[model samples]
Target: MMVRTVLLAGCVSFFWTGPVQAGMPSVSLDLTDIAQLRLQSISFFLMVLLLSALILKLCWNLLAKDFPKLPRISYKGALGVSVLWGLMFLFVLTMISGARELLTPGAWEKSGRTYRLVEDKQPDDASLAAETTLDERRRKLGELRSALFMHVATHQGKFPGKADETTFAKEFWLQPGPLQARYGYVAGDKQADPSEPLAFEQAIYGDDQQLILFTDGAIKVLPTTKAQDVLNGK
Candidate 1:
């Protein structure tokens, strides 16, 4: 009987319990572990209690005097106790699991934001020093627009009048933003043969230039926002 109880506890624990380490390594264990442990402990205790009661009943039936009646062991009582134990286990498990998620370090952990900043260090302090890089980029984009307009005016409103790299380079120096250029250009409609993978509208980001100038002449000061957005777009 003891062996059966032990085996039951072991099997149930094994099936119900998850590995000690399950979540993201950096985030470690949270509420789930607590729930698993609680359920296992309750199961173990219930098995032991029932096993003891069964053994006592067997002994009493065999050895007790006829005149001195053995105490009543109602199946109803055992069933009620088992049900109560199960419900209590479930209640505690549910409450704790829910509570742990609210209390534990998850999305609320500000460290995630800190890690993001550390991960995306700018190419230089120059990127950080600018008061408003986006604003500056917006202004530059206007200049590029004017240049594109002029190129079109000179060549009957058509891009790549001759489709020469030097001519296109001179007319519109595709200043792919740091974020956009790093990945490479998206070809514009004007260029019959773009740098490579001719795109209808191109954006260039060259590491050597130390600038992330967009084809639209917008600057990307923070590589994270602009760079990530552009890269993720692809």
Candidate 2:
């Protein structure tokens, strides 16, 4: 009856811990991390083996005292039993680890000294399209800035006072997509402060950020309110 009880307890413990251990996803590790993990596992196994041996020995002593007719188990036999228990524990751990890797799709990453799930950071189709459109707008603004500088060089250091696309060469003015609105140009000459706002998008882009150009020929993506404040000379 006592032997049956011990076996039942062991089975219960295994089932209770198995799923918890198996749920941990496998992680990618370098040589150093692998070595450390192995060392820790060995240490844990040895500790469990020692504790199992001590418990078995204590049980044997109690049984021998309480019931002398009971068959005696030697120290070597107890140690052998502990070894078997330890091996079973390690086997369960190995099975759980293998099951985790089989069930999960991605490898976890090592962050500092710990492991974390690797997240999918690839942008979705809409995000990609938005980014591509933003890039096109930036390129157009760059061309417009170059044209403005060229106009200043030829027209006595003065920018076009009018915001019309015809104020410069026809090819220089490109309409932005989705909104099809022309860039809002501010009247500024070459002699104005280099940091002064010269041009901006007529519409706000994604995340309330707008593309703005300065008299210094610098372009930036800024918040709509802040860009407005700069344009207002605030």
Candidate 3:
């Protein structure tokens, strides 16, 4: 009964340590302090040993029921097996963590004393606003593409001419906004090549990227220079 109680206590301690460590304040390790580092290493090793012992105890209990003639594991024998398992587990975990840090350096950022994952980093307001604006522009362009197609279907396969902005606006319920003002339309019919650029945004974005709508009703974002070449019929 005492041995069972000890095993239960070890299991509880092993599982509880993770959350407790996670909740503790982040401490910057002093590379010069060998004694402190050694203490931390020893604590980690002992925790792993206890966890391995608990796992072995559970496995022995399960197997003993099936193998009735099997001799029970002595404390010393269990300790030896636990140490081997613990060492292997620690080595594998260290390798994986080291590989991740080396291969994807940008995935982690040091903030104050702690390393934070890129996913956990919050976007600043300016970045958030820019992303929102870009999304809105894309959505507006999509709606405009649908409206142009509707116009083509009704007007004998021709899109609205550049001279008929008022007619196009009223027919498509398009409001005067950044999207409508910044984007230029090409006068073309449905018979034009499907990959031909039908409309494109001016190079107004800070990133020098433009959104283009094709005759086939596809929208794509391209670098401003390439988009300009396409617009100029090159």
Which structure is stronger by TM-score: 2 or 3?
2
Write the residue-wise lDDT of candidate 1 on 1-234 in tens digits: 999999999999889866675566565446587798888889998787788566655555556556356665455565566667678998998797667667753533236323221244346533533333445444554455556545656766554323252243442443324333212334445532222221122223222222243433344443444544554454
lDDT of each: 0.48, 0.75, 0.72
lDDT of 2 by residue, 86-128 (tens): 7799899879766776788466666886557788898754454
Q: Predictions ranked by TM-score, top down? A: 2, 3, 1
TM-score of each: 0.24, 0.41, 0.39
Comparing 1 with 2 on lDDT, the higher-scoring candidate is 2
Residue 22 accuracy (lDDT) in model 1: 57
lDDT of 3 by residue, 40-143 (tens): 88999888777777778778867988999976785567788888866799899889878989999889877865677877657664454345466777887887
lDDT assessment of candidate 3:
0.72
lDDT for model 1, please.
0.48
What TM-score does candidate 2 reach? Answer: 0.41
